[model samples]
Target: MKKHIFTLFLLFNSLVLLAQESYFPERNAVWEQKSSSDFKIDSEKLNAALDFAKDNEYSGSRDLRIAILKGFEREPFHEILGPTKKRGGPAGMILKHGYVIARWGDTKRVDMTFSVTKSFLSTTAGLALDQGLISSTKDKASDYIWDGTFGGEHNSKITWEHLLQQNSAWSGELWGGKDWADRPPREGDIDDWKFEKPKESGTFMEYNDVRVNVLAYALTHVWRKPLPQVLKEHVMDRIGASTTWRWHGYDHAWTEIDGLQMKSVTGGGHSGAGMFISTEDMARFGLLFLNDGKWKNEQIISQNWIQQAIKPSEPNVNYGYMWWLNRKGDRYWEGLSENIYYAAGFGGNFIVVDKENDMVIVTRWLEPNKIGEFMTKLKEALD
Candidate 1:
């Protein structure tokens, strides 16, 4: 009788575990939706949160080309070097336990997701590490690329971790964009920045697209294939993301790899060209991270990589491997969990992953300043 009781206890635990498993949408299958009531969430508060997002759409021009140029007007010589798309109005998805709890606007409309591309770019590096293509993040980048990109004394000292953390301080030019020219200090003129000594790598944090592109270029050589293909075969396809998503680089960012000329993609759409993806697909990505890089049964990206990717670097508590953390820092969203991390882009694209709450939030074209408040509102609803 005691043996039979043990068997029943095991069966009961298995059923509970099965019940708590997340629902993953199959390729081309309609994603399942659940009412807020199903999750015991306050329906009125949830609707109010969605209404707030809709009411406060991004202030940028719908013609993102104009918005991109105007937004970066402070930077000299900035130009649209790749493709740009007119954006759709305030589109988003809120997923709880892998089922859509709330959705608004054109969730299927593909739009440019500027610097959020950096998070995806970093994913490629994680893949390389997982596959033994990169022995370690601590490995010097110069060891992999003996070419002049990492030639200088300062650049040679940079490691994969430095680039991933956006603290490489890599000095030099790539594809006609100078490292200092990307985003110069507000108080300094062109000559001041151009001649200034670069900070020691991994000691300072700076958000320069030129340096970001260098990382992309290095990873291209590391993977020996276009990043989009690597991502598609290994990640996006595996996650059942829609075929509409695209990754792009500047028009002149082509390089010869494996006897074929391929475009080395940028980590952002700063001067245009990064990720062009729909809201639903973005939610799918957030879901993958929410589950610690697992999709249903398969671990597409190792949990070790994801954990490292979200760890706050010494230089920036709010940043980790190109993903933004909600930890105490300049960019922290007050009243939110410090454990939350997200991918944010210009013109207000965000893919927020809330592991503590078992939720993912994807919002596009919402005013950049409103994210903190928006998140707070969403949290209130869930509470």
Candidate 2:
């Protein structure tokens, strides 16, 4: 009887702790916070894993299973997420071992990662290339654009690369007020915010969510199926990600976004954060990327893509197609010589690939305002 009473008390205390995390003010969902010690993988082994992560974080490796349990609170790196005039939180870090070294986080974890979803979306594009579903990135965007009539002359001049590079130069604040009425009404708006479509296509990175959303539309057309279907065969099937892993906008486990899925501009419309997965799954993803798209014997993502994806070739932004570049760093690689490439996600998510060291470091945070400093420190540590 004493033990039963104690267990109930513990659960009650956990409920109270969970109750503290909600902001809805009305529907407060209670959950207990676990510490890193509660994780499936041991934290002590972290250092031992760094060497492997430094070596093969790109490819998906099943034999490597050193998952780390990182129980830490998340702090927003954004100056905006600072004190609610109520409380404050700070970012924390931990490292994990497997094929490559990685760090995991556990705090008010995993908010929507915004444009980072573009990287996932780009995987679908890469698969299209792999399966020969789509012919080329050189194709004209106007061809797939809903308004095919206006696609003549100058509009046709815009290539899919322009769209990928965000060089198409569409300057409307894709997230703000609605000035654009030429297109259809965006989905999921309780209110109608207008957007002004920037007349220019590539002069500057004046972000237009609609532009990337157009890629969703194009993928739908080229694949002749929803973007979700292609993602299943190409990425999910190959990676062995958790079933709990879900790509939002995909209706079913089998049925994909068949019709008009990618029609809207995803940047503003679909923040990259919608896709959810466990931190370990994310590390697997980072590893696959680091490995240049090899998951076991299956060459899921192509070598040409791994090479092209990492290359710093875009004209305007330091950003690559969907992948971000860590190009400007010193000529150092795991105490060797190799260029570093990475998939940088908004809100402090990074899959840092140190090819020479054969290491891939993946991090998640509410906002690690410390990213810039942290990366610098990390690179130094590896060197």
Candidate 3:
């Protein structure tokens, strides 16, 4: 009887603690700035977290367009997706209890957030699933994308889940780019790449932009509208994201849909066109996920979809539906919960969501190697 009473007391306390949590931000939500003392965070530790972020900035090329062109080493880099813009220096913001605890750099500057766009693409897919355009993620993509794109026997075996998890190895040329040309075997010669044995679909994971673009192309067909528009109406606008952001596709990524020329968006800023968004906007996105896709009283992304979206793929434990998850013990700070997942981009753009702490972190242009340390210091600041 004593044990039962103790359990009941603990449950009541948990419920009371939950009741004290802050409300989710509404549309055009007011930014509430609070000091470390307000949250019981150690001021010195919070300062250390800020200093660590300031000290560890992205040391890569300042002119991101030039950097991308030089990195690709191919003239195809000249093919602009949408509109390329100059990126700013390291910047970030931290939010606890839906209030800003810290921020740095140009939070409003619009800059390319490379592969982090993949998570947006994933959200679009979730929208499709919610609308019933997709019967099941396990269904073969070729069944719906009946075009020759997925006609090849090997490609036909690829499922939507396989594509979402980066395990599909889908082969084809998209927008004048070949599948094998993307992130080709680092040690192999041209001949070896051309004649390499194909792995079965869903058997191996490869981070190829070409295949990622394939997902964008397939999704564009399903929606019959520009993905940017889909995203705007469904997510960004709903989340009260700023109007400055844009999603871009390659110059040749345009296709005729319903008698209109529609551009199929790229999954990342790989060739210099992806999500050009502000850090605060990205934080809003993170906050949405942190709240289990709820914004105020409305459910934005279904909790069931969120669960499936974060489920680890067989081949990659650290990835899920385009989101980078910190599932493994060694991948993130030990002090943080394993439930933490983030949308990461090249040149160190990141939006980290921690449900347990009701925290959202947005960092732009931080050194990738120092993220764990940054996270560790941030965790220490709590209480």
lDDT (tens digit, per residue) of candidate 3 on 136-199: 9999998889878888779999999999999998887888777776765556475677667668
- Residues 1-383, candidate 2, lDDT per residue (tens digit)? 99999999979865664444211111122222333343233444544343333332222111111110011111111111110111112222232222322333342333333456677777777777777765677776665555562164445666666677666644232223222422333364423433333445545443444566656656766677756566766776567654555444412112224433242224321222135544555555666775678766668889886675655544633466777665544322333233666555444455666554445556554233444445554545543
Candidate 2: C-alpha lDDT = 0.48
Task: Give all candidates' CA lDDT scores.
Answer: 0.93, 0.48, 0.84
Worst lDDT run of 10 residues, candidate 2, spans: 66-75
Clashes of each: 0, 44, 0
Candidate 1 lDDT over 1-383, as tens digits, reads 99999999979865764468788988888899999988778999999999999999999899999998988888877888999999999989999889999999999999999999999999999999999999999999999998788997889999999999999999888888988888778885788888999999998899999999999999999999999999999999999999999999999999997799999999999898999999999999999999999999899999999999999999999999999999988998998899999999998899999987788999998999999999999999978
Q: Return the top candidate by TM-score.
A: 1
TM-score between model 3 and native: 0.92
Ranking by TM-score: 1, 3, 2
Higher-ranked by lDDT: 2 or 3: 3
